[model samples]
Target: MKRIGVIMHGITGRMGYNQHLVRSVLAIRDQGGVVLKSGERVMLDPILVGRNGAKIEEIAKKHNVARWTTDIDAALANPDDTLFFDAGTTQMRGSLLEKAIKAGKNVYCEKPISDTMEEALAIARLAESAGIKHGVVQDKLFLPGLRKLAMLRDSGFFGKILSVRGEFGYWVFEGDWQPAQRPSWNYRLKDGGGIILDMLCHWRYVLDNLFGPVKSVSCLGATHIPERFDEQGKAYKADADDAAYATFELEGGAIAHINSSWAVRVRRDDLVTFQVDGTHGSAVAGLTK
Candidate 1:
């Protein structure tokens, strides 16, 4: 068995709780855990590290993980730990990652690895210099629809990909009727949240993997909602974008158009979808069964 220790931050946040703790880590443990091709078991020993002790305890109890803490230094100093997994807010990610790398831990993180390209590149360089194994979560590629599309593309079922069109949106109903589901921080520019930065990270990987590397891009964005109420029922101004329309030209002459929005309603069954056209044939795919 390969013994591993993980320092997981932001366990109380939405993405951290839903995606990392429950879906990824616990689910991995539930399936008799990760196994090497040689039949060795990959034992994942995760230490839930977060600011909220009560929430951390609650999550840990439900998941059956024993180790939990709010102290970053203590987690790093432990000799048994080998990995640092970060799902923190975008603004805090760089500093935390830099500290983790300096402490000699292999890193796995959620993406738009930094709010800016420069910070992102700096982290990349640090990882390279430290010779630490690193990965950014490109989880959308693992979704059933996208995975099937990938299989078809790899089998040459669609000859040569000529163009890709993507549609992604859902109406964020106001709190008075349906209650606002998204965090208030998302609507603020300073919080490193916006439809463009949030969704484009997924697009970056998808286009590169399925279509081709993007050579150039032009985009337009808008905030359809001007104001919103915070979780505390206080009024707040929304300064970030709620929608984006972008066109990308790929290295191999493939063109991609993307529409991402939070102000639109989902009338159909699928909220996000794509269609790829090619020389031999075409395929239409969606985030639906």
Candidate 2:
């Protein structure tokens, strides 16, 4: 078995814990790893890293991950650990990736890689200069619905694709009665949080691949819920925007309108929905059937 040792950062976070560590890596581990085209079995060995030693250890033991560490520098120094995967907060992500690259480890992570374009570019450039493999999550394109969209595009099912309309939002409970679903840091600008910054990053790749290059964007944002409760039930001012109304012009003269909000209740077929219209056909896709 060719076991790849991956040093995973921020696996205790929501997406990091549930999606990446559990649904992805552990799911693969439970299946006895993956068989290569050459018939060699490739397995994964993950070392969990976080600021909280106790939390990281708990997760590691719970998931049967072999190692846990609060010392990232020590983990990076391990010769057996060839890959560095991060699902940490966006503000710290660039620095973590830089460290991994400098250590000569292959890197992958959830986005946005950084809060600013300059920082994002710098990370990419560093990875390139170091000649290390790197990638940001563009998971939307892999969805069954979006994959079908790509198929339609590739097959010329959409004759001269015209436009795309996206509607995405849900009512996020303030931590008064029901606890806030998202982390409190996501509501603070200093911690790299905003509806536009979060959703637009996802939309960037979605538009680039399915529709076309985005030519320009005009956006208006709002922080609908100003005060929200934290995990400790303490209320704090939400400086980040909870909602955004944006319009984009794609390269092929296609106009896209998207409304993303966290303040609205869902009554529609899907929490998130996209409508792609073309001369030949049109289709609607959502979070679920």
Candidate 3:
């Protein structure tokens, strides 16, 4: 068996803990690792890293994870760890990725890779120079519904695809009566919080892969809720945009419009849905069905 050491950072958060660590990595481990084409078994040995030692330690104990630490530098310094995975805040992802790349570790991180295009490009250049594998997490494309959508597109089910429309998001409680579903930092611009930066990245890949390459875009953003309660139940100003309405022009002459908002209540089939119209037929897909 080939053992691959993965340094997993920010697993304390909701998405990191539930989706990446538990559902993905641990689930893979439970299945006795992955079998390659040559029938070689490859095991992932993960070392969890985070800011809170106590919380991380608790998680490690619960999951039976052997290694847990708060020192990111020490984790990066270890030569045993060949891969570094992060699901942390966007504000810090660029620097963290750069550090991992310089330390000679391959990196896979959540989007947006960086808060700015310059930093994202610079990091890409540096990773190329260092000869390390790198990628941003685009989990939406792997969803069962989207995979079905991709299949339909490939089979020409949507012949001469004319347009694509996407609807996403749900109402997040303001934390006054009910606790907010999302972290408060998601509403603070200083913390790299905004609906546009978060969801547009997903749409970009979804459109390009399922429809065609996006040529240009016109977007309008809004801060639907001006104030919200934080984790501590303290009121804070939610200055970042909670919603986005965007239109994209695909290279193949297909128009794509996506509406994403945290303030909207769901009356649709799913929390998120995409409907594609074509000369031959039309279809709508959700997260699962």
Model 2 over residues 18-119: C-alpha lDDT tens digits?
989999989989999999999999998999999999999888888778788999999999999999999998889989999999999999999899988999
In model 3, which runs have C-alpha deviations exceeding 4 angstroms?
none
Candidate 2 whole-model C-alpha lDDT, 0 to 1: 0.89
Where in model 1 is the C-alpha error above 4 Å?
none
Error of 3 at 186 (Å): 0.7
In Å, residue 278's CA in model 1 sits off its true spot by 1.2
Model 3: lDDT of residue 266: 64
TM-scores for every candidate against the unseen true structure: 0.96, 0.96, 0.98
Estimate the lDDT of model 3: 0.92
Ranking by TM-score: 3, 2, 1
lDDT of 1 at 243: 94
In TM-score terms, candidate 1 sits at: 0.96
Model 3 weakest 10-residue run by lDDT: 263-272
Global lDDT of each candidate: 0.87, 0.89, 0.92
